[model samples]
Target: MPVNMAEDGNVAPGLSAPIGGKKIFFVRHGKTEWNNQLRYQGATDIPLNAEGRLQARRAALRFSLAKVDAVISSPLSRAYETAEEIASFHKGAAVEKTSLLTEVDFGEWEGRTVAEIRENYAEIFEAWRVNQLNVDAPGGEKADDLYERCGELSKLLLARPERSIVVVGHGAMLRALFPRLLALPRVSYFWRTRIDNCSITAFGADAGRFVLLFQNDTTHLKVAEGRIASLPLL
Candidate 1:
């Protein structure tokens, strides 16, 4: 069983700190061509589109006022580029790439649109929607595998020296990891949670306990008008 760190309306005790807890700002990578097309891009390295770059710039402006100590990102180009934008605003803050932050592998589903998947793999899609934890994308990574990776990521983040940092990653991976971080059930994965491109989520650690301060905040991108594309469900 996965470790439960959070409870209903209460924070869990985890992620130890020497002096005090750290603040982690989690940001989904900027929009990609696949995102605009409503395609599953798991483990598919796609670069940010023009709108994505603009969104990253807006995010950078928002974080410019923040005391960001470091910027960490998935090895994928979209995530790495977004991290670069955030790091640009913070002097001496370099972007660190980690494979642990990569998107969940989609296997046969990679690069396929929702419509395509539904038309061909309707039953599989339904199975995934009903209980993603027990389903796999043909040959992709399973929910349990993702959960384990998320745990690894939690440990990696907790082991970081920086108190304030930014993490850029994919939608599916973030959604999968959120339950573990907040002590929610794996069955609740992706439930009522929407991770838009360049959206910001905040968390703080206190004496090893992780507290979710906010989730999927896009106030910074509101000024971008329609340039911010609609996020597709992958």
Candidate 2:
């Protein structure tokens, strides 16, 4: 289904689309303290901050009237909490956790700031920052490994019976996996895509191909307080 926002900037009721297939809405988890600090939170299991909780609630309201058959999320607390908020609106939809959706393991980089990475792991950080290389963190998950994991998740979701699903996850993992889900090119390219906290992105499978109905639409976040969510250094 194609989600629309009304003239008043509220999520409009009656989301419908001409091209129909299984629908997947990918939602990034709400703001965590690490998010604001621009720290790498890979595999850290950080919870939602106060503002994040409110954002999750607003995101919940966005789906209050929609038909979500299933809600899937990363096992990480941030993602699971966000999924829980969204699933609350759909009485029948229970939050399902999967390590397949977890953020890229930053390894030694976890909990470090971008500035720290630049200084400590200067060469690799520069390479990743400049070319989006498929490099691995010191003792952590590599970009290529994360891509394959995402492929597995894609297969799992497509094989399921649910027609509509909501997946709450981290930005880096979603960036790596979504391109594969859409059958796009190198996952590195999509690592540049900005997935704002609690933003709602949508797509549908049509004729065995995924159609991008919308990307990173944060209109629902208007209901929450005004604060820009900066990207966390993954």
Candidate 3:
């Protein structure tokens, strides 16, 4: 059996080699009022703004060209709808949703603004800013809990050797996800990584261990950074 190292994104320390398995793309759901406002958007279920819809459309255009096998998304309306848009653009694709992929549940602070969170729960908010796995949000899940939830489910998907899939979900979730792609360290989630709206990233697994191939590259978004001159050299 291959070890599930995606919790830390590690390579050799935890056994590294392609187990003839593959991982697919991880895309953050498009922006929303809360996202643009920098609010604690955990499980609030806000729909995409006009900007977000356009962003998803751009992702759809790109998806139409790429070859993806399936698409998964958070069960929230925003993510579910966004996944549907991408699914429609693809050839008879299915957009599936599951609780495992949902955004972090904020409990009492679900729809509140960041400023409100800071004002009402300053210390707790501070801990979150630093990415504490032990600190629960008001009444919601902390990083580690959500990680294991999404982590195990995602790994199950990667266990299959076939199927190039896409996952549409929230930023905080993706933040937790990126660092764990190869099962490195939980603390690595906050190493200045950013997952933008409708961005695309891909990874591969050696045996049960995973390896990151691409990360947050939305060049298909028609953004200035997507062009050839903007990409970095390997």
Alpha-carbon RMSD to native, per candidate? 7.0, 8.3, 5.6
Q: What lDDT tens digits, residue by residue, belong to model 2 across residues 1-234?
A: 664432122255454434466888899999999999999999998999999998898777777767789999999999899999889878889999989998888899999999999889999887776544377788788767777898899888778788888989988887777788778777365446778999888877645556677888887776333222221101
In model 1, the Cα lDDT at residue 27 comes to 93
For each candidate, the alpha-carbon lDDT, in order, equals 0.82, 0.80, 0.73
- Residue lDDT tens for model 3, 1-234: 785665444445555444234557777887788788877778877999988888887677666656667888899988987898788866756987778888888888887787888889999878877765556787888666877875777576667555567788887777776666666676736447777888877776555656677778877666642443334311
Number of clashes found in candidate 3 = 15
Highest-TM-score candidate? 1
Look at candidate 2 and tell me the lDDT of residue 214: 83
Candidate that scores best on lDDT: 1
Clashing pairs in 1: 14-208, 14-209, 15-208, 16-208
Q: How well does each candidate superpose onto the true structure, as a TM-score?
A: 0.85, 0.85, 0.81
Ranking by TM-score: 1, 2, 3
Give the clashing pairs for model 2: none
